[model samples]
Target chain A: MATATKMRFGIVIFPGSNCETDTWHALNDQMGAPVDYIWHGETDLSGYDCVILPGGFSYGDYLRTGAVARFSPVMGAVMEFADKGGLVLGICNGFQIMLEAGMLPGAMMRNVCQTLVCKYVHLRVETTDGPYTRAMSKGQVLRIPIAHGEGNYYADEAALADLKRNDQIVFRFSTAEGEITPEANPNGSLENIAGICNRERNVLGLMPHPERCSDPILGSADGRLVWESLLQAV
Target chain B: MAKARVTITLKKTIMDAQGQTVEKALHNLGYEGVGNLRIGKYIEMELNGAPATELPAQVDEMCRRLLANPIIEDFHVEIEE
Candidate 1:
């Protein structure tokens, strides 16, 4: 057996972002290389292979979900990173920001019934072949935390068709029997989508927080595979 | 010189769970007859630096990239000089 070298990951932090440290420790401290925090106001993105957008109420959620975050100074650097074929992951509010920035497909619309949802849920990996899920096998149920006011994912008909055809739909929420259940679908998302990857396979936007599930101390650490998945790529 | 006030709202088909929650809260607070409530966005920006010809495209890009989430929200920009 050989020791795999740790890789570099860049986590983006906006003024209201609250999950940067958690994500940093979950990936860097637990699985991969040390993580670096990229300020939202900074425009230059350099020396990092993976870009992460952490969750928080940006601009007090003044405009909409991620409406105010897409214009952050550091997003230009993130956009450039995506264009150059770099890995990018958006979690919770990060997922909203990605949709707003047009970095990934679809949007994180308001959840169905409009109540703040916070609980542990099961997420099935639809594709483990991608960089973000490579460490896990399909049909694996990960006990992860889901806390958000607006996390429903949506896309137009054509776009949804394309996403399905292109295999960009990465994760789907399911129940104990591995059946897609409307009850398990906490968010009012189409097709019970929990996460997705961009066409390039480098950009992954997921509503649930994998960082929150990286340690057993916090509870179920089924999300360790996600961090494990990224340990290989730089 | 002209600028626009862009207002974006979630599509009617989509459920505004936040608004509904707030509406319920309002009703619970003894406020009645409030038929509906929907939460959206309002943005006002003055673009004076760009040349007149490029302003529209710039605003369009701004709306497409940041101002609105095209999947479930629709936007309208009111221009004035």
Candidate 2:
């Protein structure tokens, strides 16, 4: 494993963000990484190398899942951090916030089934070129859990072209056999997209809860690969 | 005082999953021959003291910045004085 210098991870906690503790434990305890929870009201992001917006019903998913949370004070700093090429990862509701804040491209719509889906899913790593996927090999199938009512990813044709052209499409929903098929598309996301990175490759947003699947006893340790990859990338 | 009404809906190119689900339910309930049903959000806000002439632009910015996501949603702002 290529180990970069020790990096401190900061998890942003919105009013209703429920995954901070899980994310905190995953990084601090499981990975032996330094991590802390930062309030949404905080505007200073001077100390952290990587900032993660964990999943949850932020603001009770009011005015749309991540709409209100996009205006949080901490988001301003997060944006600044991102503009300066900081590594930003948004999982689940965090992905919604990233889209709402225009930090990432595209938007998330309600699942095609119109039901809250909570289950483990297989995702094929489309690219290992981003900060988060640096340690993951291309085409690696990872079993990660996703719990959300709105996870259908949508993007316009031009954006889709750009994503592919820039190699920003980092992961696609796939079967355990690594076949990208419609049946494996859990949320009806465009082209079964499960995750994507920004043009700069410093910001990544995805619907699955990678942190939740990082422990072997928890059923899958594939999620730890993302954290480990991020560690080395930073 | 002015009231701004924001109407937000999924872009035509995007599928409205919830709307389609509701459409199915409606069909099952015997509401046959129903046209396309699209679900969207209607937001009403009262602006205090902002100039009426500037309301449209301000409202547009609000839609672009918060009320709507341009990627998958289209929004229109109607002002009532």
Candidate 3:
């Protein structure tokens, strides 16, 4: 097994982002991966092997979720880091920021029910080739929680096809039995996509809170596979 | 100074769940002749200086870059005379 100390994680903190501490603790304490809180105003991320944009109502989700926070100074550094092939993970609101930053293709729209959904959902790992899913076998289902109002992932047909062709689709909402169904999809995301990665496979954006489930006490430590995968890959 | 009014709406193919919900509410309230209610954003901004001369293109840029997300929404800009 790869030692957790091998990977250094930086979780960005934007005003109105309430999940930074959770992410920090998950990485630093629970997973034992060296982690630090990188403020949104910071312009440097050279010290980290991976950058995480943790879930939260960044910039109060003003204008649009992540629309404002994408301009944060740290994002410039984060983008540079991603362009240079460093790993980047965006969870929930962080995923929104990634979409707004154009680091990932597509955008998230209001949930079909037009209400905030926060609960444990089953996600089937769609691809294991990416750094984030290396620990999980294909078709493996993990229990993770998604909390957000805007998680309806959408893209043009061309973009969607491209994502599929490149095997960039990382995970899909699924039933506990690993069956993908509309009833299992908490959000009306296109094709029930819960997560995806860039063509380079370095940047991943998903609408689930993996950090919340990294601890066994949380009732499900399935998310640990992702964190462990990060350490193993780096 | 010149002002630009921007109207942004989801693309035709995209599902507008909020608008659908609002439409259902209107139907329950017995509003007549409500057809295809699609909720959108209306923004008004003021501009000054040389930028005002290039208002249309500038507003287009704004819509493309920030005011609207081209993936799911389309934006129309109207400059005040």
Candidate number of the best TM-score = 3
Model 3 stretches with alpha carbons more than 4 Å out = A1-4
- Order of candidate numbers by DockQ, starting with the best: 2, 3, 1
Clashing pairs in 1: A114-B17
Model 2 residue runs over 4 Å out of place are A1-5
Candidate fnat values, all = 0.94, 1.00, 0.82
| DockQ leader | 2
lDDT of each: 0.82, 0.90, 0.91
Docking class of 1: medium
Candidate 3 C-alpha lDDT tens digits along A47-138? 88999998989989877899999989898999999999999999999999999999999999999989999999999999999799999999
The local lDDT score (0 to 100) that residue A1 gets in candidate 2 is 28
Error of 2 at A218 (Å): 0.5
Q: What is the TM-score of each candidate against the true structure?
A: 0.85, 0.95, 0.97
